[model samples]
Target: MRNYQPATLKKNVRLASKFAYWLDCELSEMTSANVEDYLIHLHQQGRSAKTIKNHRSAIKVFCDFLGTRGILQDNPVLRVPSMELPEEIPIFLTDEEVDKLMVIARLDDMFCEVTLALNTGLRMEEMRRLEWRDIDLKFKQLTVRKSKSKRPRTVPLNQRTCKALETQRERYGHLVYVFPGGKGGFYNRGIWTEPKMRSENWWQKLSIRHIQEVIPSLKNLPAGRTGRGWHDLRHTF
Candidate 1:
């Protein structure tokens, strides 16, 4: 569907599979009570409310598809309540931290990624989907076509960002993606696959693990916190 990205579609498929594995009866026999029970099971297993909510959403979509196909007369997940997440303050890098990070990134050959993220505030997914054709160096702007909000937006590039991008272009300009994967494909090839089964090229994405390794201070922070990942660069911007 136009509303679902490839990665998102794969995730939903995986979640649906997991749900089917957990259920005792056939999927056609599933009911709203079974869906509620599964949610309770997730909660009992110490799954976060957000995680359970995602499970619910995925299962809901699957049930809807089955309904459309006449495989089921009713959708099970419709009766489930939406998960309410607690509000938390976002954390960002300090000026001193940013300077240090940039210095290290330059040394690590990630200067372009770090600079572009900080300056343009693009999400990791947006950056991963970025193409050379999306940028206009002469105009000092880039367009985000695959944003989470599903709306294209133009981001103005600063001098630092432009310089970093120029360096990247010189090295990988002929490639389709600005930050191509190891085989000159999109970054994080097979990213939707199970981690243990993924190819070596899976490491090509500018992931949070890479960021944490570069900035050791981030590694010590609590998991699931805002400042621990690459998004902090966007926040810093």
Candidate 2:
């Protein structure tokens, strides 16, 4: 934890913590059968096969790291059977629902973030790491240095994003994060969850969580639960 970067370490440890829980044993006790059961638990929990695959990848990397340190006999993940996932087309939201969200937009800061995600397709981590200097106001562009693939991409801002940004200037500032925390500025890393298709802090954080509660019209939309994770809003675009 002390050696690795914070976010990377957090992800590694989170996987380890779950592995411990699933196997009812610590990292030292992890074995081939235990790893297999973990995958089984994921299936029982209704996690998509793709999600299971990603979780396995994370667990495998951590297990391999443990092997190098002489903690495990070998990476048990390598012993687990390869999982087969279904081939499903991507699901996206209609433009009408997107417009409905805007009509009900109350949090100016969230509006900017949602607007940017809709127009530019920036992921949560990318948007969180974004500093004021990264936004190129003159060029009407937002640049993310490293996204999911660890590749930097630049996205052009449409008239809508500009208007959303402009509307946010008073609520935030040139240096303040476009998405500020309750008191002000970037969220303290303590208890923040990724904004799923639902909304930021939808599952926690009472104040911001209520944004969805207040906007009842959106609850009736089909994309509401199917792709409730906030990234679907980006996926929809």
Candidate 3:
């Protein structure tokens, strides 16, 4: 109900619902102690601090809403201290690393997609939904739709990006998607497949293979927990 992006709203509602289900008590019965106990429960379940923090925030907001409706005297979240989060520095790929990736990517089907990410700083999801119609090679501009910000923005393309796309278009221009999956449809499996976007995981898998092929040590690099991924390409650019 709050002004949240669709994905953020969904996460908030899901966490709030989980808390309500766990408590199995009326709003009036909820208290600061109950909220603290819920946090303990989450910690017992092995949820990470960041994840627990999100749950805490959702419950806190719900408690505030209840207060606004004259249902409580104080916000329970205020009684509890915020979770201590481990600092994480974002890692960006080096130019040599990016160049190495580019060399291998040029031989793969995702070369165009890879080039766009390196050039435009578009997210994986944004790259997935990108279509041939959204690109103007002559003008070196790309239109991103349904972005995470819930707004469309145009990304100006570099010469390398345009050239890569031009080559991709020459080969796979018949398909609606700029980066079509193997089956001539969207890359991911979902309810809506219109001009379906490729899976970020799929690209990551290929990228990892290529990276390891060049430098074996990179293969062992932690990927999910503060490791290199597609986002690093955006950071690199």
Best lDDT among the predictions, by candidate number: 1
TM-score of each: 0.81, 0.70, 0.68
Instruction: Choose 1 or 3, whichever is better by TM-score.
Output: 1
Candidate 1, pairs of clashing residues: none
Candidate 2 per-residue lDDT, tens place, 1-237, comes to: 345544556666787668766667778788888878888889899987877886787688788788889998889899887788778665455766667565534333256766777788776667766755567767898777767666778888888887777766544554445554443212432222222222333312322233354445334333333224456567777
Comparing candidate 2 with candidate 3, which one achieves the higher TM-score? 2
* Candidate 3, 1-237: lDDT as tens digits: 556654467667889989989995788878888999999999999998988999999998788888899987788889888998989766567767777877766555456777888888887767777888998888989898778777899889899889888987887677788876553212322212235555545555555655667754366555542225666778777
Q: After superposition, how far is residue 188 of candidate 1 from its true place, in Å?
A: 16
The deviation in Å at residue 76 for candidate 1 is 1.6
What would the TM-score be for candidate 1 when compared with the true structure? 0.81
Model 1 agreement with the true structure over 107-181: per-residue lDDT tens digits: 555678778988999977788778888999999999999788899999999998898899888877777777765
Off by over 4 Å in 2: 1-12, 21-30, 41-51, 107-109, 183-228
Worst 10 residues of 3 by lDDT: 184-193
lDDT leaderboard ranking: 1, 3, 2
